[model samples]
Structure formats: structure tokens, C-alpha cells
Target: MADLSVNFAGISSPNPFWLASGPLTNTGYQVMKAFDMGWGGAVWKTVGEPVINVSSRLAAIDYGGRRMMGLNNIELISDRPIDDNLREIAEVKRRFPHHAVIVSLMLASDPTLWSDMMRRVEDTGADGVELNFGCPHGMSERGMGSVVGQVPEYSQQITAYAKSGSSLPVIVKLTPNVTDVRMPARAAVAGGADALSLINTINSVMGLDVETWLPDPHVADRGSHGGYCGPAVKPIGLYMVSALANDRRVPVPLCGIGGIETWRDAVEYLLLGAGAVQVCTAAMHYGFRIIDDLTEGLNDYLDRKGLASVQDLVGKAKHRVGDWNDLRLSYSYKTVAEIHADQCIGCNLCFVACDDGGHQCIDRLPGQRAPVVRKDDCVGCNLCSLVCPVPGCIEMQDIDLGLVETWRQRQSRVGF
Candidate 1:
């Protein structure tokens, strides 16, 4: 059997699957349950001075009928007392020394506080520490999370402080709201962080009450921006991790996060060079048992691929990712939209998409420009094809530039 064990930051995990620090891993009870259920590791929820959470702290939105495709939360760090968390951490470590128990921390902006917390957390005999640098709401407003993560300097300084204070290795969780992901990853490395985990939930507003026209999970007449995480954020998170991994200078073990709901999602992260993968929203949505899919699915996939270990798959896809300019210009794809005239109800989604998105390829009725794609103008970009909920409304005609001198003339030849 292919071993799924992963060695990250010198801490070996039974598998690459890990529980991201969030509401799902808030209590020792939750952490113990997750470890029992097959997750290789768990980053305990952000802990600081105990703070009560709002009554309606979480909200969710579904995509394509998938319950909880995206989630939002205004919750702060661990509501459990700091002393209690430390005690549980000690006990959890005593029980499962082989599993990774990285205590996630959020505290005052001062270096002294971070230093003290790092020392205290290290006392628990936890394998490592993950600085919670990317919660976009509550704690962020208090200047303890994303506020610090957004600045490379602060991220670097705090990471350095934690490194100096803790005997255990440190992984800094990064915020994805920044313009470029490379900056902070590099900064963490500069500060001597042993590894990097990302991305924390993005800033988001859950939804609006159709009646009052206010955001839901509504607070008294108002709602604050919450951290957005779920299946939706996975792709974005993967991109950032890949970008950082691709950078030759920063090879810190990456704790991939975002929308990791299944084994397939976890594989993509590992193949993108993540030393391990983490999940929060999905666990919260599906319960700790979700790890059943996370582990079995990955193991099945590895077996099918004839691989013996998770390490074999890690970074297998990294080299395949390249700069936009290096993309094969020769790879030409035409728009292919299926029009289900019966189901379309003449919504004009395809027509509007073809017209506004790119070329006016889609043409409509004789009098009303119903948006039928003009085969000639359609670059086959597929924009029109995708919007046609009616199925195959506007289809892009595949163009082999070899058959047409157009692209050759557009590029190699200039108007003299």
C-alpha cells in the first residue's frame, strides 16, 4: 500500500489531511473527535483572551444545490479560556503524540503578547504553532488578525517574534486579500517561519434578507463582513499556494487550505506542493465524518495512480503551471454553447453574454437581436456557450489557424 504519510517542517503526519483552525476545531472535544476520524492533524482554533461570540455568528450560501458551497462567519478566536485550551492541548498531546497538534493563536498587536503566548503554547508540548494571521472579521477588527497579516512587515515581525519565543516549529497562516501572495510568504520565510498555511477566509457578506433587504444571519438591524470560506474559495487558495510554491526562494512547507471538501481537492493541493491540506468550512458543513471521504478518496486515488505515497504526488503539477505569456498560443478552442430552446424560454442570457462578453457572435430573432453567435466573429472563447443555461445555445466553431491565414497575418504581418 502506498503510504500517505507526509513529512512537513520535520513533523510527520499519518496523512496529508488536516483540520484547519476555525470554529470546527474550537474545543478539545472537537479536536479529539477529528483525530479519531482520520484527519492527520489539526490546527486548533485561534485562541486568545476568552471572548463571547455573537448569537448569529455564521451564515452560508449554497452553489449548484451543494449545501454550504460558501460560508461566512463573524466569530472571533476561541471562546474557551486560555488556561483551559492549554490544559487540553497538554492532554491531547499526551494522548496523540504522533498526530500534529498545531495551536493557532490570535493576540494583541504587541510583540510582548505574541512572545508570551508563543511560550505558553509551546509549554503544551504541541508539535507546532500556527499564527492566525487571516481572519477577516471580528478579531481582524480588533487589529489582531488580517489587519496584521495584510502588512508584510508586521507579518514578518510577528512571525519572527513567535519563532524566537517558541521551541516548537511555527507556521504562519496567511491572508489572501493581498494583491500578490508571494510577498507575505517570502516575508514569513525571512522571519524564520518553519512553514506557511493559507488562505484564511476572505472578507464577505453572507446574504440579504429578501424582505428587509439586509444581510442574513442578520444581527440587530446590521451585519458585519465575515470571513468567507468554503468550496468556492478552494481554487483561489490553490492558486496562491501554487504561486508561492513555484517561487524558488520560498519552499516553506505549505499547509494548503480554502475549499478542501473531498479527497480530490486535497490531492490537487498536495500535487501543487502543499506539504499538508486543511479544511474548516467543509468540516463545519459536513461534520468531522467528512474525513472519511478525505482519507479514503485520497487513498483510492493514490492506489489507482499506482503511487505508493503522498510525497510522490506533491508538486507533480507545479512545473506544469507557467506564466500567461508562455501559454500555448497555438492551442485554439472555439465557443461551444448548447441551446436548449425548450428550456431557454428565450432568456437572452446567451445573447447578452455573446454580445457583451466578447464578439457579437450570438444572433437573436430576426427583429430582436436574440444573440445568435456569428461564427466568423466568434473566437470560440466559450463565454457565450457557458452562459446558455438552456444547454447548447451558442456553440463556438473550432478554428484551426492552419486552415486560415488570419492569425498569422494578425501577428506576423503588420499594415505597411
Candidate 2:
């Protein structure tokens, strides 16, 4: 059998699927249930000084009427008292000794406070601590969360404080709001972090209310920018994960978070160099039962691919990622749209779009109500193929260019 287990930063879990720090992990009941449902780990909802969240704390963006395509929230860390969260962590870790229970924490920019909290969490027998420096909204306003995450100095200082206070491994959760994620990633490594988890939500406003001219999730008819998560942020999260994984200065293990909803999504993160992956919104939208699909799909996939374990798949695709300049400029293929006479509905949508927006390569047939691609004028752009209503009716046929050469090599050959 393909082993799905993972050991990220020395904290071994039955599998790489972990519940991210969010509403889903706010209590021990939720964490325990998630473990029972086959999640290998859970980052306990971020704990710190108590916070009072706004009445309307969450809003979402949809695509084609799907719910929660992108979620936005102004909520802060755990609203429960610190002692309560600590006690729950102790209890959950004691009950589920085999599962990875990582404590997520945030605090005011005081090193002493951070260090003290780190000490308290270490006593709970948790596997590790994730510094929650990435919450982007309410907490950032108070000099916590992404405020610290946005500054490399603050990130390093706080990470150092956490490491100094706790013998357990330290994982720094990074925010994506910054211009360059590598800056904070390097700082975390410099401060002795054992691993890094990212990316926290992005800064966003989830559309506006036309009636009041205010943003959605308006509390008392007013609103503020919130942190965005869910499926929409997966690409951004993957990009940041790849960047950190490829950075020489940031060698720590990575726990990928943000918009991971399925086993396939988890595979993409692993192939891009993540040691483990965390999930939130998907579990929020569906239920913790989704872990069934997450684990089963991954296990089946690994077996089919003839891999021994999930670790073998990690970072396999990293080398394939390259800068735009590194791309093969000379690789060329000419594809022309081919129309099937039988499948053509004579809608002429493809013809109209191709004629006006494309290279005007499509022509109406003289006798029939069908259109044909003018092969002489076609540059093989595939505009007609794309706009065609029939699926297999209009398809692009590739014209082999016979050779491939990079622009750099071509320039060198031409003596440029």
C-alpha cells in the first residue's frame, strides 16, 4: 500500500491533510471530530488575547451561483479566553496523542507576550506551534497578525521569541498581502523557524451593496476590507509556496494553506514542494467528511502512479517551474480550426467572432449554411475553435514546425 503518512518538521501525522486555523478549528469538539474523520492534523484556531468579532464577520464571492468561491472575513483570532484555549489544547492532545495538534497563536507586537504564550502552549503537549502572523483584518489593525507579517524585522523578532521560549518546533504562518513573500520567509528561517505555513488570506473587499453603496458584509450599513480565502486563492497560494520552497535561504519544511479543497489540490501543492497541506474553506463549505475523499483519492492516486509513499511525490514538479525568460521561445505549432459539417448548427457565432475579433480566417460557404476556415489566412490562433458552440465540431489541428530553438540560442547563432 502507498503510505500516506508525513513527518513535517518532525511532527508526524497519519496523513498530510490538516485543518487550517479558522472557524472550523475553533474548539476541541471540532478538532477531535476532524481527527476522527481522518484528518491527520489540525492547527488549533489561533489563540491570543480575547477578541470580539463584528456582527457580520464573513462574506463570500460566487462564480455562476456557486457558494463561497472566495470567502472574506474580518474576524480576528479565537474569541475565547486564552486559558480556555490552552486547556482545550491540553485535553485534545492528551486524547488524540497520535494526531498532530499544532497551536496557532497571535499577540500584540510585544515579544514578552509572544514568548509567554509560546511557553504556555508548549506545556499543552502539542506537537508544534504555528505563529499566526498572517490574519489580515481586525488583528492587523491592532499591531498583530499581518502587521507583523508584513515586516521582515518584526517577523524575525517574534519568531526568535517563540523559538527561544519553546522547545517545540516553530512554524511561521505567512501573509500574502506583502509585495514579495520571500522576504518574510527568509526572516522566519533566520529566526530558527522549523517550518513555514502559508499563505494566509488576501486583502479584499467582496463587492459592494448597491443600495447603501457599501461593501458586502456591511455591519450597521458600513463595512471594511477583509481577508479573502477559499478556492480562488489557491493559485496565489501555490505560487508563494513554490517561491519559498525554491528559495535557498528558506529551507524549512512547508505546510501549504489557502484554498485547498480536494486531494488533487493537495497533490498540486505537494508536487510544487509542500511537505503537508492545510484545508479550511472546503471543510467549511462541505463538512469534515470531505476528508474521506481527500485521503482516498490521494492514496488511490499514489498507488496508480506506482509510488511507495506520498513523500515520493513531493517537489517532483518544482524543477519544471521556470521564469518566463527561461521558456522555449522557438517552439512553434500552427493549429487551424477544423469544422465538422454534420455537427455545425449554422449559428455563425464562431464565424462572427473569428471575423471581427480574430484574423478573419473563417468564411461562409457559398451553398451550405456552414463556415470554413480559410487555411491561407489562418494563423492557427484557434479563435474560431474556442468560440464554436459544438464541442468536437471545431477543433484545432496542429501543424508541426519541425524544429525548436530558443531566442537566446538564435541570437547567439545570428551573432547579435
Candidate 3:
């Protein structure tokens, strides 16, 4: 059996799965529930000088019939009192000492505010603090959140301030809105960030209704650009994490964030060099129960792959990545699909589609037997692979188009 336990920056968790700082971690009750549900740790939501959050501060995006798979929010940091948050953090840590109860915080334009907040939160005895430099909406307009992240100088100075104020490890949570991610990343490390967590929600607004002319979850008949997170943000997050991990310029422990709902997503982040993977949107949308799957699923994955621990997977993919020219240009493949006899109902959907909408690649008789794939003419565009009822019924295969440069040479010689 593999040991999933990890000692990250002197903070030990049973695993590398941590709930991110968001709506789900807004309180001790929520954090406790998440811990009970098997999350390795939790970063308490961004707590500021008691905020006055607005009514209906959330908006969403729907694509492919999935609602809130990608979420947007205008919600500010924790609207609760500062002392109350600290009390809860103190109590939660005493009760669940094994779990990493990280305090997340955001505050005003003044250095004194940052200094005071870090000192106050540190008194709670939390394992660490993640400076919220990456909320894309609401707070950004006030010279905080993503606004702070966009300016490298601001990030550097504030990080230095936070480092000065905190006794615990200070993890700078970065925004994705910067021109180049590495620039801000470098600034944070330079200013003394103990660790870096990245890819906070992006700015986005969902489409509007046609007849009503109002965007969904209407906020006084209008809505502002909100922080976007969830499945949609995973790719962007992965790219940022990989870029920083692979870059020799930035050398800080990374806490991977953005759109991770499952263990596979966590594994990918760790393989790309994250010490831990954080969840925000998934917990907001699906509630804290998903942590069970996040933990057990990763355990099963480790067992299957013969991985002895979570650290074994971290940065595994970094070495495999190559420069542009190092990529194999000679390798080529054509799209192909193989139908499963058991899964196929012989609906001829692909046949009709190919006949009318696509190239004449699919074959089916009007009133005949099972629709059969004609390999000779099948271009492997995967149209048939889609519209199939059962998963794996139609498998997409890449057929060799065969030596493209050689074909070009023959054609040139014959002038064909």
C-alpha cells in the first residue's frame, strides 16, 4: 500500500488535497464539514475588515447543458467579523490539529492594514496564511485582490509586509490577469513568499436573455464581470502552474488552484509540480462531499500506478516537456473510430451525417443489417464516434497518414 501522507513546507497533511479559500471555506462550520468529508486541509475564506456583501452576488456560465460547471461571482471576501473568524480558526485548529487550517486574508490599501491583519490571523494558530492577491472582481477595484496581483511592485512590497507580519508560512495567492504569470511570480519570491498558490478566478460574464434582455440571476437588471472558476478554468490553471514549475526563474512551492473537482485533476496538478491541489468552485457547486471522491479516488490512482506517495507524482511531467523544436514533427496520425458491437444499436446516425454533412466516409444500408465502418474510405473524423449512446462504443483511433515529406517529394517529382 502507498503512503499518501505528505509533509509540505513543514505542514503535514494526510494527503495533498486541500479545499481552497472560497465560499465553501467561509466559516469554521464549513471547514470542519470539509475536513470530516476527507479533505486533507482547508484555507479559510478571505477575511477582511468586516465586509458588507451584496445580495445575489453570484452569476454563472452554462455550456453544453452544464450549469455552473464554470461559475462567476461578484461576492467579496468574508463578510463576517474579523475576531469571530480568528476565534473559529483557533477553535478549529485545537479540535483538528492533524489538518492544516490555513487562514486566507485580504485587506485595505494601507501597509498597516496588511501588517495588522496578518498579525491578528497568526494569533489564531493556523498552520499558514494564503494572501488573497487574486480575486478578479469586487475587491480588485479597491487596490486589492487581482489589482494588487497585476502590479508586480505591489505584489513584492505586500508580500514582504506579510512575511514580516506572519509567524506562520505565508503563501501568496496569485491572479491570472497579469501580462506574464512569471513576472508576478518572480516578484512574490523576491519579496519573501514562503509558497505560492495560483490561478485565482478569471473575469467573465454570462450571456444575456434574448426577450427579457437580462442576464441570468439578474442583479437589479444588470451584472458586472465576475470571478470565473470551475471546470473551465482547469486548463488555464494547469498551464500557469506548469509554466512556473518548469521555469528556473521562479522557485517557490506551488499550491495549485482553479477548477479541480476530482482526484485525477489533483494528480495532474501534482505531476506538474504542485505540492497540493486546492478546490473552490467544485466545493461551492457540489458542496463539501466531493472531498471523499477526491481522497479515495487519488488513493486508488496511486495504488494502480504503484505510487508510494503523493510526492512521487509531483513534477513528474516537468521533465517530459520539451522546447518547441524538440517536438516530433514527423509523427502524424489520422482520426479513426472503432465501433463496439455490444454498444452499437446500428442507428446509422453517422451514416446520415457523413452522407449529408460530412465527407462520404460512413457506410450504412437504408433497410439493412448493422451499420459497418468501411476502413478503406473512413476518414476517422470521429463524427460517428460522437452521437453514440454508450461511452467507448465508438473509439477514436489515429491511423497513420504515412511519411508526409516523402509523399510531398513524390508528388513534386511527378508534378501531380
Candidate 4:
């Protein structure tokens, strides 16, 4: 089997999967249990000043009978005392010496406080300290969390403070609520972060109780915007990770987070340039035992691809991501959707979708069950393929007219 171990920044793990900082890593009991279940690492939930949590702190967005497709929470950082958390961290590290034990921290903007916290965290024998600059809800209102992450200068300054206080690697966790994620990312790098992890929970209000007319997970009759995460945020996470990977200024390793549920999802993050992948909602939904499947599936995929190590897959697809101007504009280069009669279930879902939502390039015969594609009018939007219930029923065939030209080339040719 291919080696799945990864050395992210300076911390080595037996595998690339690590439990993200959240409710799961709040206690030593949970962290130890996760290590026993085969997780390679665990970032202890954000620790700092204590705060009381609301009775109703969780909310979910369910779709198509699926529960928690997206999870939103008003949850704050670790409410446990700093001393208790540090003691547990030390013990967990002693018991599982090989596993990566990282501590997530969020505090006020004071450099002394940050430096002091760093020194205390390092004393716990933890492998690294993750600056939790990305908490979007409760912490943000207090001039911390995403507040520090949203501003590039603050991110850099705080990271420098942490670096000055501890010799251990510093991983800055970035917020996704910003208009340009790269801004803070570049700032964190400037602050001397050894590595970066993102994207922290997005700001969102889960939903409203129609009957009560209150927000979801309301405290009594009031509701507030909370941090949003889960499967819904994967696309955003992938885009941000790819953006940083393609950037020349930010060269540090990336730890991908947001909506990773399966090994396939983890592989997608890896291919985009994440040295390691973090999980939260999925583990909360399906128990820690899922680690078995994650490790096994990733190993199987690597061996099948003739890869000797998981690191080989990192950034393999980064070059494939680029701006629209870089895309081929050649008229001869085209792709049209084709339906396989053998695989077609005679379901008109694709035909309906294409006619209504996409280009009207599909037609149904008077008596035929399967729809035919109009090659000339087909735009290859992939809408028909996406709506098809049967896999492989609709395939997009690329047509090469023996020509290639990009928008940039056309601009130069026009000499405008």
C-alpha cells in the first residue's frame, strides 16, 4: 500500500486526516478516543477566556431528507479553564506521543497576551499552535476571531507576536467571511506563520422558525448570525485552497478545512494543494469510526494509481486552475453532450432540465423515450449530464477542430 503519512510544516502524522478544532476536541477524553479510532492528529478546540454558552446552540439545514447538509452554530471557543485545557493537552501528548496534538487559540489583540498564551501552549508539549483568527460568530463581535483575520495588518502583527513567544510552528487559521480570502492569507504569511489552515466557518443565520418567527437556534426569542459549515462549504474551501496554492507570495503549507466528509473529498483538497485535511461535521454526524474508512479508501486509491506516497498527489491539479482569459477560445474546440441509449433510463429529467435551465439543445421524438441532442446548438454546459439520474447516461464528447487560440492570443493578434 502507498504511504499515507504526511509531514505538514514540521509536524508529522501517521496519516493526512486530522480532527478539526470544534466541539469534538473540547476534552481529553474525546481526543484520546479519536486517536484510538485511527485519526492521525487532533487540533484541540480553541482555548482562551471562558464564556457561558446558550442552551440552544446548534442548528442544521436539511435538504432532500438529508439531515445537517449544512451546520450552523453560535458556539464559542473552549469554555473550559485554560489550566484544565493545558493539563489535558500535556497528558494527551504523553499518552499518544506519535500523534500530532495542536492547540487552537483565540484571544484579544494584545501582543503580550498572545505571546504569553503561546508560551503556555508550548509548555504543554503540543506539536504546534493554530492562531484561531477565523471564528465568525461570538468571538468576532469582541474584536477577535474573524476581526483579526479580516484585516491583513492585524493578522501579520498577531502572527508575529505568536512567533516571538514560542519556538513551535504557528498555523494561522483564516476566516472565510472576507471579500478576498487571499488578502488575509498573504497577511498571515507576512506575519511569519509556518503554515495556514482555512476556511473557518462562514457567517450565516441557519433559518427562522416560521411559527415562532424567531431565528433558528434562538436564545429565547432572539437569534443571531452564527458560523456556517459542513458539506455546503466544500466548493468555497476548494477555491480558497487553490487560490493560495497558485499564489507565489504565500508559499507555506496549507491545511484544508470545510465540508470534508469522505476520503474522496479529502483527495480533492489534497489534489488542490492541502498538505493535510481537517474534519468536523462528518465526524460529529457519523462517529469517529469513520476514520477507518477514510484511511483505507485513501490508501486503496493511492495504490491503484501507482503512487508510493500521499504527498505525490499534493498540488497535482493546481495548474489546471486559472483565470477565464487563459481558457481556450478556439471556435473549433467544442464539446457536445451525447446520450447513451443503453444506459439511458428513459427519464426525461435531463431533457426537461436542459430545455428549461440550460440551452434548448435537446428534443424528444414523437414516440421515443430517449431525447436527442442538437449538436449544433449544444453548448456543453453539462447541465443535462448533471441532471441525469443514471451515471454515464449523458457524456460530453470533446471535438477538436485541429485549432487552438486563447483570448490573450486573440488580443495580441488584433493588435488593439
Against the unseen true structure, what C-alpha lDDT does each candidate score? 0.82, 0.90, 0.82, 0.93
Name the lDDT value of residue 282 in candidate 4: 95
* Candidate 4: tens digits of C-alpha lDDT, residues 1-416: 89988999999999999999999999999999999999999999999998778878989999989999999999999989999999999999999999999999988888899888988998899999899999888888899999999999999999999999989999999999899888999999998999999989999988887887999989998988999999999999999999999999999999999999999999999999999999999999999999999999999999999999999999999899978787886485888999987788887998999889998999998877889999989988899999898988999999887767778877898852
Q: How far is 144's C-alpha from truth in model 4 (Å)?
A: 0.4
How do all the candidates rank in terms of TM-score, highest first? 4, 2, 1, 3
The clash numbers for all candidates, in the given order, read: 27, 0, 2, 0
Residue pairs with clashing backbones, model 4: none
Worst 10 residues of 4 by lDDT: 324-333
> Order of all candidates by lDDT, from best down to worst?
4, 2, 3, 1
Model 2 per-residue lDDT tens digits across residues 1-416: 89999999999999999999999999999999999889999999999889888888889988988889999998888899999999999999999999999999987767788778888998999999999989888888888899999999999999998999879999999999999999999998998999999999999999987776978888897899999999999999999999988888988899898899989999999999999999999999999999999999999999999999999999999877756545455245466778888999999998899889988888897888789888767887777778787899987787767765556666687754
TM values, all candidates? 0.86, 0.91, 0.84, 0.97
Off by over 4 Å in 4: none
Instruction: Estimate, for each residue in 158-236, the C-alpha lDDT of model 3 and write its tens digit.
Output: 8888888767898899999877899889999998988899889887876678899887546787777888888999999
Candidate 1, 336-360: lDDT as tens digits = 4445454456777767776776667
Clashing pairs in 3: 335-380, 336-397
- What is the TM-score (0 to 1) of candidate 4? 0.97
RMSD of each: 4.2, 2.6, 4.5, 1.4
Q: Using lDDT as the measure, which candidate wins?
A: 4
**Which TM-score value belongs to model 2?**
0.91
When 1 and 2 are scored with lDDT, the better candidate is 2
